[model samples]
Target: MWYLGSWMFPVISAAMWLGMLLGMFIYWEAIGHPIYPSMDRGQTIAYISDVGAYKLKPLFIAGACVTTVFLDLGFLAERWLRHAGRLAPNTSRAQKVLSVIAILFAIAGSAGLILLSNFDTYHYPRLHDAFLLLFIGGYWFSAIFLCAEYQRLGIHYRSHHILRLSFWVKLTFIIVEFVLAVVFASTSYTGKPNVAAVFEWVVALVFTFYVLSFLLDLLPSVRTSHHQPQGWALKAEMEKAHHGGQQPGAPLTNDSAGPNQNRHVAPGDDLEAGAYRGTSMTNGPGYPAEHNDLGRQKRRGIGRLWS
Candidate 1:
């Protein structure tokens, strides 16, 4: 059977998140935008949580939980693809650390979303607010870390414009969400519940775009029958260049040797009798007693090197 690329993860996540918010708004509006039990008299503008707390409790909780689960999965998939060389590898220790940190933050944000959805504002008001803060703050910090990581990745891999694009998308998300979140908080605290509710809805709407931005990051890793991902192609080119334009595991030969001969041994070439698949020159016993003249150790191959 045919399969779609991992990009579907973020697409489904964004769709579900947007659908949940839209469903709540439309349903509430259809019911004449009644003042929810949690609201004061004359307050006709219900927060997303307020609407979800009453009639659409099940839909809100399920949608938020499912959307965030897939969102976290998307973040995890990107990191895995990067390490597996299907996407651009992290070129520095800092990049690797930042990627992991970003994933952690995404997971934390997902947890907050799930918790806040379950803890309706009508009941656990304080806990709901706290988890909402966590949900927003977690994603904001995640975007910041991703922007830093992608900036470094883009610097090292200038040809991949997708990195730059993803960086800017996330940076824009951070800026927009930060501003809206601050305003939402200020309005909520200053007795302007209607204004806060409007900003809250806007914030959720803007967050859908943030969810969609992962598409830019994951698109390069997509593969199909007639197509290869740019990430895979670039990785292949780098590997080919590193191995002197010769196919990996091919017998290295010198001018004096036959075409198929493996007589030529470079400084760090695996010398374990043509075992080139897994044996590393420095990490394993690939270096036999006869090849002691080659004193230097190359990196533990591209995986560890890039990682």
Candidate 2:
């Protein structure tokens, strides 16, 4: 089961990377092949106009938008559920509420992207704009809410340096992206940005980096959460023991860690998958404590907002 998590992280990351690259490639491909190349069109042509004329444009965009939904939803849920069973009752209500809000916004944002792709601006300008608002604005809200939640309580995460850096990086992305979005929107009064094509590309590029950073931290997080079983993962774990002809309470150990590190399954545990109970894990001097400290204390310390 741990092996599955180790592999899923990379598989998910690769899928996300491919989606972004494919989106960029097709977008650029479409831009390069304008049916009316000589038309005296403003660069906003890329943002507001020019659709089917560029044969593959919609295909690429639709594909990209769909892929991004999975990227956001998958990562957000993984991060949230990492400690879902272990949340302490004393944890701040505000932080917990914000976390829930962040997930709602993220899911909404994903839905918005699908709607934006399905309804072209040419025929459904109003609906397209609405979904665009949901896509961009919803994500902005989700990010800020989640970041603020962490800032109020993230000091306790085990990967101290990495967690701090990730939060700040996300904060930076949000600030700069917000500023650029405002600037882009303000230009609507003039009906066009100074360099519409450049402006559009810049916004997309910034967002791409924002997401890419999350890709880096995502794997370690999944691996960290693997130490404690959750949901279906827990079920798989029990099934493995049962299939091995061992009871769920059978003692297990990393042979290399020596007998001192043997871990005996607690009685009454695993009666049902995903039962929330404090689990005892073994650690040895041979292994870095941090690597084995995948307890609820750290996993539930602070939530990551796509950073």
TM-score of each model, in listed order: 0.78, 0.58
For residues 181-206, could you state the per-residue lDDT of candidate 1 as single tens digits?
A: 99999988988999999999999999
- Cα deviation of 173 in candidate 1 (Å)? 0.4
Worst 10 residues of 2 by lDDT: 271-280
Superposed by TM-score, candidate 2 places the C-alpha of residue 28 at a distance from the truth, in angstroms, of 4.8
* Candidate 2 lDDT, 1-307, residue by residue in tens: 4455433433453465456545655665666834334223454235522342245446646554655665565556445544563211114678678777877887787788678767766667678778877878877788787677656545644333544565687788889989887777676446563454446556766766666555433443343443433234444554786767555666554374543355566766562233233323325446654464455445766233212
Best by TM-score: 1
Q: Each model's C-alpha lDDT? A: 0.84, 0.56
Candidate 1 wrong stretches, greater than 4 Å? 239-307
Give model 1's TM-score versus the native structure. 0.78
